[model samples]
Target: MTDQSKHEVQFFTLHGKRRAYVKAGEGPVLLLLHGLACDHRTWLPVIDELAKKYTVIAPDLLGHGVSDKPRADYTLGGYANGMRDLLTVLGIDKVTVVGHSFGGGVAMQFAYQFPERTQRMMLVATGGLGPEVTPLIKFIQAPGWFPAMGVLTLPGIRHVETLALRSAAAYGGGPLRKYTRDLAEVADILESWKDRRTRFAIRHLVRAVIDWRGQIVTMSDRAYLTEAIPMAVVWGREDQVIPVRHASNAAALAPELRVEVMADSGHFPHKDHPEQFARILDDFIVTTEPATYNRARFRRMLRSGMARADTTLASVDTALTTA
Candidate 1:
């Protein structure tokens, strides 16, 4: 792995708003998207390694990270449009998108909305596969959740809360070990929430996709579109937030999906197993051909949509192993 500290975040302005991102290395483009409440830093683990061979562009999504967070669109489709515009401004034509968690939903939407610009897709512990999600996410939808966050971020209280979470994250053994990283991540998220604007933005973003019943949006309906785009889905076997089972759902919907479940990893596979994650990603890009968009074929699929709906999901690979 290369020295992550050496990678500096660059900024760009779009629509009069400033956005922060990290661009490194050179070659074919690889657009890395981080999960909710996380910024481009989440990709630091594998960014340098991947950057060695590919031009890696990891952006802090509009509402997350240091990006300007105003009263702007935060829906999945809105996010997809934002990515397309960003790519346009950067003068990039096509890319193999890599998205984690909420970013995964945006990746799928990006491909769906602008297939011509998408070369391939790589999803990590992605959302929008199913309605099942962790209670922690659902709890955000609960009334007073925003107010509660405000209280938690109070000066003295914030320090104590972050300290407790960090302590739990440092525990070396027993069941807590399995969730130590998650605890640490939660602490980081809490720290970020100390900024009132970020808290407000996150609230709107979460409400747009989640509800009491879990994730309200999904990619299952359009999974058949993968026939025109090569996609690989990576998930941690023990991902408590999204659950590894969701990967099975995705594979079932798109038989062509390359599924890999990392053992002993939770939600953040790239963080827990950076080397393996980078290797798998590099190998996939090397082995699979980038998708070439054909207008006629896309049109036929769109025309045959309802008739072929039931036939979309043909088989299942419930086994949590590399495809």
Candidate 2:
């Protein structure tokens, strides 16, 4: 069991709504963004260790944790703007933005929208890289699923559901063992849905990015922008939620991207191996130079459209040859 006492939850009001977060340690700022349906607590596994070397600011993004769930914008752009406003109010000028799953999409948007404020970006099993996603996410976008979820989480029913999930995640072996970690994360998400507001926020948020087929939004159109930012991709080789192959999609877009696949881990690689995750992240920060954005170059990339396929492939080949 995690020692929750180590994390002191704090609150701040933004645009009249109370937002909850945990801020700890001090040094270069690290803005940790949690995935959809999760709160700041999801980072508990590595936050303390990370905080020892850097100032870590992990917020329950607007609608998720103890933050207010209003009829507000949940789009990626809105989330990026929210991060900017939050950092501005806190007097944090820049950050090494780190995001997980949906939070990864937010990290990319934050970097794109405010490159000057983002020194580097780290994506962990993030979305917007490709169209493939677990069927469960797609199912949530299905019509009537919200109300059905409501029924599933009703009073006594939720207890049984939670127990079943935990049992299966813990003891269900054979083929199911591969997805045990993913199942555990799903159980946590379901537990949060007991709150009506959380369910509403999750529904709206899911619909915004996912569809019946799979993910509707993608970063491929703007992937060339990675040239201006120091970025890294980390994915669990066994990740069932977002396929680990998406890491290659990111590498294909920008060959400079450092892709680390954690074997035997699922969607939550950090959770599966917190020590290794922290070590990898710390090494990345120590080795890579933070991005320095130039307005002229930014304008040039925008005007040039996506980098030519041949040029991008050549760069990939060159990076491989050099490695």
Candidate 3:
């Protein structure tokens, strides 16, 4: 039997693209999804630990890491369906899906579209919960923004960031300012921007759900729909990107959602507090009951949604016909 915890990158042809992912262990399946402009590397710390008792599969999404970047749909639904196809090919019938940030949106869509295949769903510092997000993320369509960022991603990236930090510190801006200026977030952003395909893909990905103001897409409206799904919402109190308040807001939307706020952590709680994250995940999997997919119940939900849509469409059609 394989150790499951320690593993290397593997490839499988997904949608005619050479997709990269890491698979380990052999038990119940666990699918890990990463955030925007990120890949499977984001969950490096916690993957091994979780793999100890469960089969872990982490993919590089469609365009982010070493995966092929095709000019295609970047919507949550598209990504969700892509994952379903990938898993089907891999012979994974069901999985406990865990997602972080942008990946959280994909996780929810996965449960929504293929409830039968999702054993449970967990969101970490997820997006699509609220309208608010960090200013850093709302960098779309700003005048001169592309040029400025283009310069930053150039060679000597560290020198530029370092000199700026030193200048701030020398000007008596204090260590706090220097530390704030130098964060891993920038490094992560640069990682994707290093390649032209990834850079374009990241922009497309960000634009799909985010705007200059903040996140444009939201799951709050549908959060209540997950009542039948065993769900958990984990966030860092110090999350620098999405607000932790959204966690509570999401719980209110679905009272049954298990909410966990990792104190003394940031946006990347799984990276900052891997042990705690692993334990929380393990507990959730062990304690909560895996959802039983009932086709009748699912059909009812779909009908409910269609009924609402029909009402709106009827109003429009009636008005147009009268006119």
lDDT of every predicted structure (CA atoms) = 0.85, 0.86, 0.78
Off by over 4 Å in 1: 1-5, 310-323
- Compose the digit string of candidate 1's lDDT tens values, residues 184-251: 78888889888888988888999999998778887766777888999999999878898788888888
lDDT per residue as tens, model 2, 1-323: 22363778888898888888899999999999999898888889999899898999999998898899988888999999999988998999989999999999999999999999999999999998877888988887778888998998887998888788788888988777777766766777887888888888888899999987678777776788888888999999989898888888888877788999998789989888999999989998999998988999999988774456445545643433233
TM-score of each: 0.93, 0.93, 0.85
Candidate 2 ranges with C-alpha deviation above 4 Å = 1-5, 173-175, 306-323
Best by TM-score: 1
Relative to the true structure, candidate 3 reaches a TM of 0.85
Supply candidate 1's per-residue lDDT for 76.
88
Q: Which ten residues in a row have the lowest lDDT in candidate 2?
A: 314-323
Question: Which residue pairs in candidate 2 have backbone atoms (N, alpha carbon, C) closer than 3 angstroms, thus clashing?
Answer: none
Q: Over 4 Å off in model 3, which ranges?
A: 1-6, 141-145, 162-182, 302-323
lDDT of 2 at 266: 90
TM-score between candidate 1 and the true structure: 0.93
Measured on C-alpha atoms, candidate 3 has an lDDT of 0.78
